[model samples]
Target: MNLDDLAEKAEEYRARDAGITHEVRVCVAAACQSGGSLPVLEALKAECDSGGTCKVKGVGCMGLCSAGPMVAIAPKGGAIPDSILYREVKPEDAADVLASVGGAPVERLHTPTDQPFFARQQRIVRENSGLIDPESFTGYVAAGGYAGLIKALSEMTPGDVLREMTTSGLRGRGGGGYPTGLKWSTVAKMPADQKYVICNGDEGDPGAFMDRAVLESDPHRVLEGMCIAAYAIGATKGYVYVRAEYPLAVQRMELAIRKAKRSGFLGSKIAETQFSFEVEIRLGAGAFVCGEETALMASIEGLRGQPRPRPPYPAEAGLWGYPTLINNVETFANIAPIITHGGEWFAGIGTAKSKGTKVFALAGSIKNIGLIEVPMGMSLREIIEEIGGGCPGGKAFKAVQTGGPSGGCIPAAHLDIAVDYDSLKTLGTMMGSGGMIVMDETCDMVDVARYFMEFCMSESCGKCIPCRTGTWQMHELLDRITKSKGTHKDLALLEELCDVVQATSLCGLGQSAPNPVLSTLRYFREEYEAKLTAE
Candidate 1:
């Protein structure tokens, strides 16, 4: 299966669908499934089966999660954005939806696609997310899924792939902001006999589901990206470390691995070339610390999931003393597009430093609570107000939290800041896996800081004294402040603890645990001062 063979296969699949005049796509991703999408899907399938030229298929998430179960009706080979979308659909509404397929849309259920939620997004990572059946190998191939891996295997050498990656200027999407090309080049240059590539899918952030959605919606895309990374870094074996809490993502990924193996995409001599790669899924046991690369590698090695100190990073020594290349789900999802288009094509999209779009789980008080992929350097105001539809109800926007528990909250005053790596860091926040949680004016800044501190304290692996003890002390101080039992001395101690924990922690988890507290103090210091009791 070379380039020509892959193209022929894709064309054959497209040809089979040419006979169908109308296609009804139903969202069957986990969120919609929980909203009774399966029954709706079955109802639509039954209605379409008895009717003319209409084909019904179950696809992944359509991004407007609040209005699911969503159904899209379109002509054959039409894009999802051009489809007639129906929201909050039920089994009883299936007939009406099918009847309106070629006619006027059902006005009661129709959702216009011209809204900012749909228009503002740059959907490179999620291009095929809601369009194809996630479990179908042919569906993925038709959507140009493995073209990057095939291209790398056929035309480019290991060094050539590294050069293209470097030219793309893509940084790691796993919140570290490390250069992806630099990491790959380091592993490629190493003279190790055995190397490993690990996709860190252990997204345990409180409001983060970006990685989960990508894996659930397009498992094949991630696999293809891993294949390209392995080929470039000269690794024949890879592992995807996903948290066990995301059962749907794990199930889809497992099925994708089996299908790819059967289709000659995995196992020995992939695409009939000298480069071969094999991948396995490693399930994390709901540990937040495993999101760190060294802790993740430790968990994959059957040890207790805890972060180790870093002078010898994963690229230098990892996975039982073998060099390993670790990237998050969203990072790998970007690989196919960078390879399909030239590296410069991607570099032209985002800011000077952050060179691509970012996928975020827009949660909390926002009106549009779903997944979004926006270009880097887009303003926070645009994301929260335009794409997210602003805060629900009549409440004023107070702050928006980026990067999960590891991130800081941006006050409303700084909403105009560009959302790139350097810009966010200047505001005392890091892009920790693209979790943007909005807060309304009613939220108490002191309580918000306390909440994140509690999460960090509970999630700490207790391996190092700084993270375990420091997070616990900070949570205690925050709780006292929130309850009006704290004095000005406690406030001073809390600020001092933030500095100590940030500088002394062993891994990223502890080091960045004080972000929410520090950022709140920076912008909302009056909130804490107001809560402090007289000594």
Candidate 2:
């Protein structure tokens, strides 16, 4: 029942079950709930209940929210050709769904292998996502998981680990896109008696669930990633700062941490290595500002989470005034792969500037709406039309608002722009936590800017003058424009405020808060101009 024995048992169980039968897994996540996954689960359950040849399992979100009520059928064992994925399942079609397990083809429900959505996806962070029960730790280890952590601890040294990460060109996925190895190296070089590694899981961006999916589906991956990071950074303590809204993710992570501790994967020397590390969870009370590093560290220390003026950055002085390395959940999830597979392999996948794959919670007007990961250079058009299955209801793709409220909207003219940190920044946008929301013609640009400005205004920490007051003023102007009560002077004033906030803001939340407005103005200034004249 110890960690070591459990890991062994997990491997044994996987081998033993390698030839059992077959199973069809139905997703019962929130997205699927909206898509009526309960009915699909019930149908699968009924089919399995009635002496069906296959077993049925219920799982968490697969990141494919558009095609909900999704199911993945494994051929009992690890049979050939991989398991088939079915989307948009209905209750009445359960019998037909079950029939597709062996030979029959439920043409309507099937997601073709050649489809763009699955064709290019390389699932690493999402490896165990749709297939395994999130609550089951054993299910995770059985799926070639934890082997990475074991490899890192039992084989590689801290310096070696950092080298692999740097060479791999893995950047932070929490919108910053800083090189992962460089961040760790800075923390490692800092002279400190004690150091901390923190996982920034307070994902507040709208229409983004990359972190939540990892926590909900493969909690161990994040944990293992953290452990590897701890080893690399020579840290003994760590915290996973998740949002309170994600009760399910928090529950699963808590369970996972406990399981890891009991199995000796956490707490003390793991896998008989000389190093020791432990992880704890700090739940945020839904404060969007806490996603910032300094604020996150403040919250962990039981203080009111607010951003302070930097210079004593978290890298040098953070989390109880010691050196700390803070990285987002998705960024941490990539650690194991880099450690196990080597950095060159990872660096080879994405674009020249931004290395490694980016997992996007593909929602909005796209067709095959769900969770997807593609290389860095993939075009927005490919993502929207090809992978996202194009806009639903025959609507023309108007624009995509990447980076949530903090990111700019790239209109149809720039749909071909490659997605990466530098590339997006060049287009007056930054890759902000991989939130790609599609917009159709019905979505007014002015209104969209107003909506996101409202969000930024509400989420603003009020600690800085530029963000606290600037964003509020911008919101007021936008509100007037949306209601058709604005004039030409307002537009000029808006530009002035954007300059002030972008230049004087303390942190990223304020610095990037003007992106939505700026990008909208760049692409759709006419919308604001038209609003200047009232009837």
Judging by lDDT against the true structure, name the best candidate. Answer: 1
Q: In every candidate, how many clashes are there?
A: 0, 11
Model 1, 352-390: lDDT tens digits are 999999988899999988998899999999999999999
Give the residue spans of candidate 1 off by over 4 A.
Answer: none
Residues 44-92, candidate 2, lDDT per residue (tens digit)?
6876654545677777776667767788777763421276778788888
Model 2 lDDT at residue 154: 66
**Candidate 2: residue 216 Cα off by (Å):** 0.8
Error of 1 at 233 (Å): 0.6
User: What's every prediction's RMSD, in angstroms?
Assistant: 1.0, 2.7
Residue 325 alpha-carbon offset, candidate 1, angstroms? 0.4
TM-score of 2: 0.93
